[model samples]
Target chain A: MTRDIWKHLILVIGAIIVLAPFYMMLSYSFKSPGEIDRGTGGFFGRQEMMVDERCVQLRDPNRDEIAAAAPQYPGKSDREIRDAIMEEAAVACAMRPVVFNYTKAFIEAPLLRYLLNGVIVTVSIFVIQVLVALPAAYALAKLKFWGREAVFGLVLFCLLIPVHAIALPLYIILAKVGLTNTYAALVVPWTISVFGIFLMRQFFMTVPDDLIDAARMDGMTEFAIVWRVMLPTAVPALLAFAIFSIVAHWNDYFWPRIVVTGSRDLFTPPLGLREFKGDADGSFFGPMMATATIIVTPLIVAFLVAQRRFIEGITLTGMK
Target chain B: MAVIDAPVAARTSREVNRQARTAWGLTTPALALMFLILLVPVVVAGVLSFTNYSLGNSSFDWVGFKNYDRLLSRSTYEKMFIATFTYVVVVVPVSVALGLGAALLVNSLGRIGDVYKTIYFLPVMATLLAMAIVWEFMLHPTIGVINQTLELSCGTFLEAIRFFGNGCADGFPLWLGDRDYAIWVLCFIGVWQGFGFNMVLYLAGLTGVHRELYHAAEMDGVKSAWERFRLVTWPALGPTTVFVVTISCIRAFQVFDTVEAFWPQGGGPNKSTYVMMFAIFEKGVQQNLIGIGSAITMLFLVFVMFLTLIQRWLVERKVHY
Candidate 1:
């Protein structure tokens, strides 16, 4: 074995490319506005500047080193030095310092409230989806019925229409019902995902008929068989769909933007981040990144935990 | 026992039919929800396309194709069509090819396949709205790190030289701002974000391919790598390729967040990157032209359905069980 140096090298390169934007976001979140304005910084500096806790420290402590870094400015006084440092800190904090940005994100905007709203909407949608999808999938896969193929095919066909296509009509309906600016507007319309139904039906077909027959032999009803038997065995598929559903809704911006116009109180994390972009004519880069980090953190954590099942689910679909 | 089972057998058929009816009953709730949430919107959109519906308006004046006529007359609509079509053209092939390439590389490595998959899959998991904002700053004209790096690598002297400076005098591509380059940049970003997802699919498809096929090919004097791929690999991965192509095309057409964040003026800099989805979005949300927006959406729906049907017809005919 020659050790396949090229393979290892390619892997390393792939990893770097994948990590580049993240690394850049993390680093830029720490840099002062002045440093960003100048467009140059040491590759490895203090990472804490990206957070709000270390925002004030963004200013240079070493005047001599500062001069070396930027030879443009030299003289001045004690207070002047302090002001320059403060100014630099402000700018750096402006660019991003993770902690400061987060604090500002929470304080200047109703981010926490938005996050709570997101949680409610996301959870409610998921619960309703599983409830609706499970029984429907069981019937389609296990129970023989008239028009089964036609109905399932229709559901599959629905997947072709992009979400944007229905936004207008959905908005009108929601508006007519006086549901806009409320949680109902956000969650109710998304209760039944066609993709979820299709996915569950597909997975349900893989469940052995013998298992269902065995359950039925024990005097279990169809609903009981679905909830008690099929549901437990379909954990991997459910987890797979969970990742998809969570990511899709979590990152969704346009719908939320349209629906929750009157209530900043009910904004989701993405909407909250958009609002926190620039207020008072100055961009809150530090807080924005902090908010971005916080908003994205849960999704990243979810993926990390369920990665095995997620990959399996995706691959299974592909093979089909 | 055989004599006793005769009556039970007679009842079994009726029992099955009864079970089927109950099953259909259980399905009603989900079907209704789907109809209310998905189908109703589609039907309403179709009906609304023929009316002059807008926000804060009680009456819907029956316009009867006037909205469609008006939209078709607008230059922005034409530009949006071209931009969206171009985006689909560029994004589909590039993304599918890159995905397959990445999958092959990871599959060949064997042991660290999961690690490679995870790294690439991170972007797919990333929050797109937040990520788009991050990219905007990174692609900023003056202070962007990318521009600075290019300047550093090329050196200020080379940048100043007439040969290089003639086309790019501003020293860097105004990636988000320049109309001509914006769509291309958006396509690249879209591909970058999505390639990992399709890679995972291809990787799965590769694993399912029987190793004996390769052995047989090898026995047939297939020494060249391309020949092996053509004979042994391509046919096995047919489903995966069809899947990636169709899905990627559909997704590329729906791009909105990235372009919205990057080119905020609804694809400014001379109406360059104003894609169809964004046009529909702007119509409904920004302009509140509900009827017109509905019209555009119906058009998009018809277009996507037509494309999907054609693809299904092509792929389904060739699909192997």
Candidate 2:
């Protein structure tokens, strides 16, 4: 059991290295620019009130404003009135760093919109993938078909050509068809998940043929039996495939970067974060990390809540 | 009896025909989408590789093998090959080994290991682009926490090392900006993000290894842990390692998100991180050099297919089904 001490030591170090970036990302999302620059703020950072310089800049008093504020100042000098107004603007703009960072995460860009787009694209892709894969999987597994061997062979071949490799031709084809900058560009190419079909087909093969036959004997059509009998039995496999598809597409940057070039509305979370990094300056690091945290949190939280399933789902690809 | 047999045979033939029809009905959409999306693009890329076809251009001229010629002869493409292969070569083995190592360690720890498993796997779950951005921030030259931390080592005994001494004297390496460090940094990130996945796979494989085997080996006077592992565990993990290595290789080959995030304008300093995936995107999509991009795509597909074929061969021939 003492040998386990060394094992724990090694694992703890590995854990720290692995968790460092996550810690930094979360920490930066909380700290002010000053703290981040100096690299001095501890984990949650000092929650001191920091002025929103941009907001204060917008409120820089003009001559007419100073004259207008003169009355509120009573008999005070114009300069004093201006200082008072400026001080008021500073107070109005002041907020804690945590609020500043998270607010700007939403406000600086259409982060909420980007998040929605991510949901829309990832959901549509998963749903469509399941739809296309399930029946085909069912047929390949249960139904007797001419050229089933050929179809399955074709699938094995297609799996070799990773979609990212052939993205050039796909992009060209999409551009030719005027599908780029649309959700179709994001979702169309992924609709036929050959791996999903292959995995489900394998899973469906393990299912008892008698169950399908029982449905058929009840006068259920083959399609009906597939949806009613096979799909329900394939839930575990489907859940795994769903996790795999959603995670990949949700965090997908390369495809979305290619197709959804013009429209901000169409940008996925990854794309939006990339754009944030693209234009980010030193002061903007806080919001950028906040954006990173936001973009990454959903999946990480999901992974944490259901660690076993998430791991199973992600590694299901390895079953090949 | 002959009349009855004939009717039964005829009825079965009709049923077979009906099942085939239904099968076709079910499989048609998948086949059509697969052909349109997957198979057709490979063919299109094959054809497009020989031509100077941009996206918007209606007409283009064929230059047979010319695009590939550039890929072979040009220095930039040379860098691209160097970078891509360097990433795959370095990341694959290291990550696979790390994964195997981590898996073994975690397996021994029992329930306490689950925490480590979750922590290591966090990188696999986090959006890689976001993490890449964070890494870039930490690797920033002057103001980054890495350099700031290194500066802390200035007055320490650690300064005896050249890297640290140089930092104390001149400056620490600009990790993403330095050609020497850029690719390696990317490789480190690749391992960090990837090994956890392989670890998980190996953990699953471990559960399938018979517990009785270890006890039997012990009874046979298998004295040391190393001997036990070498005799029992390693052999049991053969198929899993094969699968893990192949998957890791394919993943390492497709390392784009981090590279693209790190250096959006060019590949890294001196094109050290110019992986094939990024090269395809840059040449074909961004630069509108479709022919050249398609050429790279063809090469990439060949590499991937070759690896997968090798894995299948090993799985069939060496590993018992």
Candidate 3:
């Protein structure tokens, strides 16, 4: 037990370093701009009220409004009336720092739309990958076919081509087709995951020939067997691959950054956070961190919930 | 290829042909997509690397070896190669070592080590761009948590050290902005983000090491744990080490997300962190210089494929294990 104490000591320190950014991100999201600038407050901030400068700025009184506000203070000069109206605007905009940070995060950018686009792209990519991969994996694993070796060899060859390395031609192709700014450019290149084909083929290799033979005896067509028999048996690996695909495409910033140039509505979470950072000044730090926190929370939460599957999924891909 | 068909004499030729047809039907989509998406890109990049091609241009002159020559001669491209090789060189060994070390430490503690494993793996699971942004904030020169914490050590006895004293008297280093510190900071984050992955792989490798080898080594008078590891664990982990090192190299070579996030303008202070992936993105996608980008892409593919082939060779040889 005493010897174990030192091991625990080292691991605890590593944990602190690993968790530091997360700690900062969450803390900054809660902090007011003043607290963030001065670097005070504990994990969660004091929740003190702060005014939204932009909100108040937009409500700045013009000449006609100051003249119309003469009813409330008939004897007062226009400057005094404007001062009182400005104070009222400030009071009206006052809210807790947490509310200010979160609201501005959504309002200042289309964060929800970005998250939705992230979902759409990742889901469509994974579905298409499975649609294209599973049948080929089925053919490679179980079917007695000519050119099987050549096909598997081609898959192996394709595995050597890192998709990111060839982004130039992919981008050019998308541009040639006038699909550069569309979702098709984001989804099309990744539709064929050679790694997926390779992985599923490996997993399918372990299943018994007798199980597949039994399905054949039931008068099932080969397509039905693929969708029904092999698919069920391959669930554990497929689950891992699903998490793997989602995490990768969801967090993918490069391809989306390349293709989704002009459209804010089409931006993924990473691109949205990046665009937010582009426009943010010092005073926007709280809201910017808030944007980051929201962007990262879903997968982190899912990971904390099912860490085993996430770890297995992530590491399993390295087998390629 | 003929071997699998040898046993098919027992089956009818019609059934065999039916099976082959089904297989072709099933694999055609994947094959076509693979050809278009994967293979054709290589052919395109290879063909276009010999020419000065842009997206909208109708005519492109063949510029044989010029792109490669510029890559060899130009100072900017020279910095790109240096920065890239430097990152791969530093990141691969350090992260692999940290990974193996952490794996050993965590594996020894049994179930209690899972907390550390989970914590370490968090960086891998979370979005790297989001984390990179957070890191940017943390590495802020003035009000960042790192400098703020460093300021705490100002008047302490630790200031007797020159680096810490320099940090104390003057301001702490401007991490991302300072050229001297930028690449190393990026490398540091790369290690921090990536070692967890290698640690996970190492932990998996550790499980495959048989229990009786240690017992056998102990019976053979291996007194220290280091000797046991040197004899039994290291040899047993030979395959895993090769795999971890190769994957780390590929990943290290493709270190773009952090580099792009940190130094989007010119690939860091004076292009100190100008990695190849960023170079491709900058030249091809950003500037529409397809010729240079294709050249860099071809070179990147060669390096990656070469590393992969070496790993495949090593695994096939089973040299140590």
> Which of 1 and 2 is the better model by DockQ?
2
All candidates in order of TM-score, best leading = 2, 3, 1
Model 3: lDDT to the true structure: 0.92
lDDT of 2 by residue, A1-320 (tens): 88999999999999999998999999999999999999987998989999999999899899898887777789898888878887988999999998999999999999999999999999999999989989898888888778999989998888887888788899999999989999899999999999999999999989988887888789999888888888888889889889999999998888898998998888899999988888888899999999999999999999999988999899998785
Candidate number that wins on lDDT, 1 or 3? 3
Off by over 4 Å in 3: B1-11
Top DockQ model = 2
Over A1-320, each residue of candidate 3 has an lDDT whose tens digit, in order, gives 89889889988998899999999999999999889888998888889888888889988899999988899998999999989988999999999998999999999998999999999999999999999999999999989898999999999988888998899888888888899888899999999999999999999999999998898899999999999999999999999999999999999988898898997978999999999998899999999999999989999899999999899999986674
Q: State which candidate, 2 or 3, has the greater TM-score.
A: 2
In candidate 2, residue A204 scores what lDDT? 90
- Per-residue lDDT tens digits for candidate 1, residues B1-321, read 999999998899889888888888878988898788788999999998898888788787998989899778888788878888888899889989988988988898887777888989888878788888788777777777667666664645766777456535556777788877787888878987889988988887898899999999999999998898888898888877887788888878888888777765677577778888788878877888887888889888888888778777767788643
The number of the candidate with the highest TM-score is 2
Instruction: Give DockQ for candidates 1 onward, in order.
Output: 0.50, 0.89, 0.84
DockQ of 2: 0.89
Docking class of 2: high
TM-score of each: 0.87, 0.98, 0.97
**Reference contact recovery of candidate 2:** 0.91
Location of the lowest summed lDDT over 10 successive residues in candidate 2 chain A: A64-73
Residue A191 local lDDT, model 3: 99
